[model samples]
Target: MKKKHMARGTGALVLVTGLAISAIGNPAHAALSGQALVNSKCATCHEAKTDQHWTRIGESRRTPEGWDMTVARMTFAHGVKLSSEERGAVVKYLADTYGLAPDETADHRYIIERTPSVVEHPESKPIGDTCARCHSYGRIAVQRRTEDDWRKLVHFHVGQFPAIEIQAGGRDRNWFEIATGDVAKELGKVYGYDTASWKQWQAQKHADASGVWRLVGNRPGVGAYEGKATIARTGDDRYSVAMVMRYENGSEESAKGSAIVYTGHEWRATLKQGGRDIHQVFSLGANGAELNGRWFEANNDAVGGTMRAVRADKGVPASVLSVQPAMVRAGMRTTLAINGVGLNGEVNLGRGVKVIKLVEQSAERIVAEVEVAKDVASSSRDVQVGRASGAGLLKLYKQIDYVKVLPQHPMARVGGNGGSQPKVPAQLEAIAWAAGPDGKPGTADDIRLGAVPAAWSVDNLNKMAAEMQDTKFAGRIEQTGLFVPNGAGPNAERKYKTNNAGELKVTATVKDGSRMVKASAPLIVTVQRFNDPPIR
Candidate 1:
């Protein structure tokens, strides 16, 4: 050096001295001076100086625009605080020194030695030299990926900064080879290529989905109720599950149900009700013959439930063998004038996958589920009325004697041994459907709800609330459902043998203090139909 001048606190002097000492011990240390600069700055977020990263930078040969985006990402996304000018300079340096070349400079070995590694060789940012500047090495190495994948990722890092200025006497490809090629080769052989090691290393993050269930349905105030379902798999053919349907007030109502499948034919279920423990049993007939044995919970329960799944119609579970049914191969950008008041949305392909999701909701409208595939997607919306409207409708039905059974109403069936027919409980039951694409309600079909109509308004809600002023958020109500004693009147008997495709309409006007609102909606009911008993 031409009379080396001492600059205090520069750290340059100390760094140079340290390097000299390190070189004395191991000459290879001398080739990494430029990497040392990157280590002091760029490595704050990236990995170390390694051949893998250097090679990536060499191949990009990016223009100034590329470097601008890269630096902006660092400042915006990663919280790097470099000034705009500084970022520009760094990009210039990289582009000049390592930009792609027509010669063999684009080769991997040429760039690797030019790059640096994370301080401790993290699996994610292994070739970043400034790794120690921010995070501990242990936090990074948990990810598992292949060597080639790692190489490609390293390239992304270098391309992000294209304006790095060229430095005289800067060693390039040869330097890169020693750091990345040799070291990574050794590490890969030692670590193997799989997630097993990463899992073992990060065993703390493992999770199990025991006792998780999702429940869904459509009832006035009953959007959906999800809770733990007592579950037990009965040998190979039977699966038993029990869940409590909770009301708005948070009181529990037990719904004990189980499905029994015999041979490879169909599945059958019997549902019983109870306060704490179930007592009676009522068989629910199946729509699909094979349904007697196959019950797919279908993310329908809240995060906890035991649903013993049985193969209803199986030839090796077709859903698993094929690609997702919703994937689109090709289609025109055709628009369908979506009908139904509460239903409007668009489905499109994103990147390479199709994503279908709700984009908006209209007044009183709720989408039960949405799906778009290739050229087909279903959208829906519906309205929800307030408690006042619901009470008003029920009262109207009662006034008109439209309600066939009285004991089911809490007001009519207060005392013990109250009514002849099975009482309708105060709690919202699973939505019973009347008609769908196939036309039969409760006959078993997927019930889809379009958007809520404007009919379900704050004014309507207020009006409905006013009607229930006496009830006043009473929380939980005690009522029974359609329970008929043995020797009851004709209408009083629980008619399990008959499937009645009944319908329910409700209009409510609710009051929020002085302001009033109104809402109305429709409901469907499916009752098992009973025909003339055989004249045996």
Candidate 2:
């Protein structure tokens, strides 16, 4: 999700701050003192003796990215102008002095580490109701700021989302006042920037991040993948990376990217994968032994997963990364390839799956033609190589009894140039999982059988959707579960006489044994997204 900002606003505080900062004539290469710079540029509006204004600034710290964002907002929204060199000096000073205490981020490291499929929320009720209503709590908790900055954030919300004051719990008496006052103060007290941790972190030496590494990642509904990455230092704090990944379904993808490390910890990258842009956010472990974070599609934050990389020399023994064509229809003959390491001996393609021919064999890979019996039941079993002594690294499923539409709550935008901008379509997928013993649904024991063939369709999700005729106006779903939305311009012929946007239900059905098992997922067809960040 994109961070909202005030579009237009003016107040006595803004005027004073602008004039005071501008009054300090631009200087050429004055000694880079953070305090002196702040006194000349900000003290007029903040008044150092106010206790909650300039004094608060002196007491708080933040990450380099955090400080950069704040400085950018001040320049563009609050008229705090500075030369490029002065801006850099100011950011460096603030980040180095008022940065996050090492212990401050210990509990919430997952926010920067990007642990996959984890759900987190703030313990505070008001924070949950107000802040988390639009974005993840981790986004708010990961940053360190002063009470003054926190108060500004509250005002920023009010200016950007005016309806927030009258929405749900926000409608309570003095909601806005409390948010800009007590709530901000409390947050600053708990998440303050200055601490012994930051001092210690700043004094310690950081590890160099350019090297070869081994990586493993897991995307929900997409299974697991493993790869090798080569990182080369391109600048003092920038790196270029090349990676090759093999997915559980036997597909291989190559990616190239560049990254900038901030404050010696945050790793942000822009990568290209399969002709599409992907953004990555990772944290370099203090020990320099690993980099843990998340990578997602640049257009959609929801389509991402956990990423972990360790020095290649420190990685574990060779093992199977994934099996190609993990699932196959029973009674059909197809070529199967097992890709991994240590595959020198005879291969077993599991029970109920017959090995028709051995086309190729090697210590690290094997290719064979296999056939499943018509009477085989829908089940998953491991594939072993080199008999019982060899490694069992693959799973072959004979049937798909159930289908799940991935991204349970999908949001797709209508496409057209008529509105703010043309929208991007959403790609969907259907995953097949084998039901466990007793045929119960939604159990922990259910085995993911990988992607399978399924029929797809769309319908209105509610009365509003039906009245809007979304099924007709919106896009259609392909057999592969991809949703292609319609244009965004107004259509006088439609019932709503607006763009093709509404709530939709996408269903996927597959034949399991003799019965058809199906799953439906909610989808929202909406307006164009303006800010598409790497991680939401």
Candidate 3:
């Protein structure tokens, strides 16, 4: 066996042992390549033993964030010292080499994009009981491992948590046996390390990201935005992003950022908008023709929204993705911004809606002032931009009979009193609802009139919360429907002297005509989430 000594901290050294293998996968120039760093640094820990691949690591695969957390665990738990650049390289190398296929992660994209308030329930109960009962089902679903590796993982969990079997669900049966016998096999079958999909991915050609792209999405507090993004290749798999966003309110803003693409399709970027930092987690579409995911605030992950982009290069199909000011109040002249690709032609807002004026025109966007007739029925309208038609893109509403808060309930944490985890704020939106043909709000035919401005407030959730005065201590809701949690700690004065956690309810009041429509949702502000892995 060849021994390699690696220095950690100041004087300590870790001894690495590995036998010579017939073949080795070479990591390229480290400064320009992540594989190189993996060979020079990570090789000391994960020995190359099986079939010229690293031992335990070679048989396992994960998403970029999963690999990132694994590397971060080394830095935090093993006292391994790595510069941020070096760490990123290692993660990139591992993820690219042993990354999951695009379809493998398709079902769990919400967690990858840091989407707020996602509740995932896997189809299998044994898998759920054995693994997901502790963490997110997505964490297990997006990962690949061999049957032996799965068993080894189960053992490791028991070794670390000790009484995990008893603590996980009910201790009615042989939990350990079930985990090793049934759960491991099921996990291996569902998330096999060597699959036909991975083989196809390995042989497929990935598209370059440098080019022009059409973009559209709705930001919660702000209205819908239509724009274009230009990406230029700065280095291998790295891009410099420049974007021009035209909000429906006739306001425009530009942003620039840096991004690194992992595993070909996984695109992660960090950008600043109006001087506030934001992050983008997107999946490049098949053939690099499009991308979809979410962009979020750097300081607060919950305070962001969804975005989708399509390659607008030459010969691309004309497609209409979204329309700005989607909700046109009856009897109002609203300028609708139609955003998409290859945009050109007469703008149609269905019957009873006339395009009185064309404000602006471009290949990516068309702005037109349209007047909605006062007698127009409340229903979803199809928008036709030139040859591209988007069904249900426009919603014309005559009245808002009710308002419903997006994310009816969500879990938040109290933090920032010198705690490691930052507070998880909840951003809510009050969406107006029309009775539609059903003449009732909760029916399947109800038409959503999009988001409307609302007054935000919080109240005690229940009798226990009211008795404890939880609303007085929990947090404050901004006029924009953003809930900023109070600092974490045990209070000195109060009943029972507890932490600032609270059971609360959030209310969004929308003023429609003279009647006030209010919608309330549950909000549980409690102790910090014990773990928030990238997959979770």
Candidate 4:
């Protein structure tokens, strides 16, 4: 008996796509001779023996036209060497065994599925793998195109990837015609290409804001002094800034930076500067300021300098020579939120501040300046008791009171000081935090004032949480007060209410998973009720 030439099916033919097959003849007894005959001559070039040799197309049974196309593909694309007689014989054998039945849907599907995959087709890779890396491959394949349009993408890729080799030389314009026409032919056969639909797709994907640069801050304002910036997705990953800085005397100087920013939800830019090609990373925070990184000398030692990104759109004017802000107190942290293209040069806060610690928030950094708030405290004598006289603001700055960040939910007070009389309450409404000399808010030295309304802002909460990074709600001020006033004066009496006050017993409960942490503070809301004169 002739050795069974039961050649296994080629894997290239059988993709993950499960194609249905109709049984033609009994393979157990049919033609072992046909396999041997083809192998002796065709195997030398066809390379397909068992499953391994089957071209991606061969797995499907196709019509005569399809078979003819495959033969062309193998011979022309693969350089398959076959004599005319041998090729005729192989075609005859394949047709007799696997010819499509006229009405079978399987035959049609097989024909369709036999179209080349991206790897098998050279043109598909540029659109499929390269373009698809950042976006969808459908984005490119669906575009309606002229030969020129197709060539543009080809040229673009060749330019960007550099490793990509296009058939066209720098000046050879005709190469587009050849490449696009070939691609169009293949696509027409495979997807039944519709030019109109393709053009619509291209228009949608290709048309975007080009050449325009955007400067987006986390939120609004120009720099860190006003309020901390709130970063978003776009500015987190990419930051583009264009600015023409006008000097104190009104002379313009240009500053531009196009950077790839890793926002990580905060704003920080890794920038490449001109001339020296130096790379620097700048971190920004809320308000009207910024902090810059060290300058690396071209392949040499780096010297660090403070960079205060002054929001030129607002703030008081200063000398043009100073790019950094005036530091008021040694340790005062500041942040900036920049949103426009033009900024004033004098907005940098450079008077008497020293950066003590820096905290990163998304793309910006919170530059903490070190200054003692005690040195800057206005009152040296016996402090009066009231809600004004700058005493309330000072208490809030000193973090002597605890404020409820979530104003909607007031802390439930129990047994401490519960009375309708004008007296100090057992609990306060908000929490206050210490302020550095530069006037930047710091974390609370300790939880003191219980539950006050003034400490409900996100900024205050973040400061109260400090480096621990534990706070998640946004709040608004409901009330403001100072149990200890700055000074006593006739004008301050009405403004600072030193008379009837109500006391509160405040209880705070913070839950961490299954564990609960609780604390309490005494609060007083002063009210002027009596006009009785005091007799000495």
Best by TM-score: 3
- Model 3 lDDT tens row, 1-536: 12323211110001001211111111232353455555666668878674226777678898877777666766765676666656666666667778877887888888777778877778678888778877788778878999999999899888877988888564877888998998899988888788988877867887799999988888887778878899998766778899988777778878888777777888888787767778788889657888788988876788887888898888788888898777877898887778888888888878999999999998777879889999988889888987888899999887898999988777678988888668888888899999888677789899988889999989999999999898998889899888888877787765899888999999999998888999989999988764655556
Better-scoring candidate (lDDT), 3 or 4: 3
Q: By lDDT, highest first, what's the ranking? A: 3, 2, 4, 1
TM-score against truth, every candidate: 0.22, 0.68, 0.88, 0.17
- Overall local distance difference test of candidate 4: 0.29
lDDT of 3: 0.78
In lDDT terms, which candidate is top?
3
C-alpha lDDT of residue 508 in model 2: 81
Off by over 4 Å in 2: 1-65, 82-123, 134-136, 145-164, 167-169, 177-205, 216-226, 245-253, 272-277, 296-308, 314-401, 435-439, 448-453, 511-515, 530-536
In candidate 2, what are the lDDT values of residues 1-536, reduced to their tens digit?
A: 11212111100000011112211112233445544566677676557853223654654555554565566557766787665555555555555445564456556665554343335657676666656655567667767776777888788788977887787566656878888877887777766545566666767777788988767776544556777788998654557889887776668888997765655666667788767777677778676767877787764544666677766553334444445676776687888876555555666766778888889986455789988887676566666776433233433455565677766567778866565455655556677877666566568767677665677889999998888888998888776566778888787878857878879998888776687878898888888665432122
> Which regions of candidate 4 are displaced past 4 Å?
1-236, 243-253, 263-274, 283-301, 308-536
**lDDT of all the models against the reference?**
0.27, 0.64, 0.78, 0.29
Candidate with the larger TM-score of 2 and 4: 2
**All candidates in order of TM-score, best leading:** 3, 2, 1, 4
lDDT measured at residue 302 in model 1 versus the true structure, 0 to 100? 10
- Model 3 weakest lDDT span, ten residues long: 8-17
lDDT digits (tens) for residues 427-481 of candidate 4: 1223322343344434433322222223212222333333222111111212232
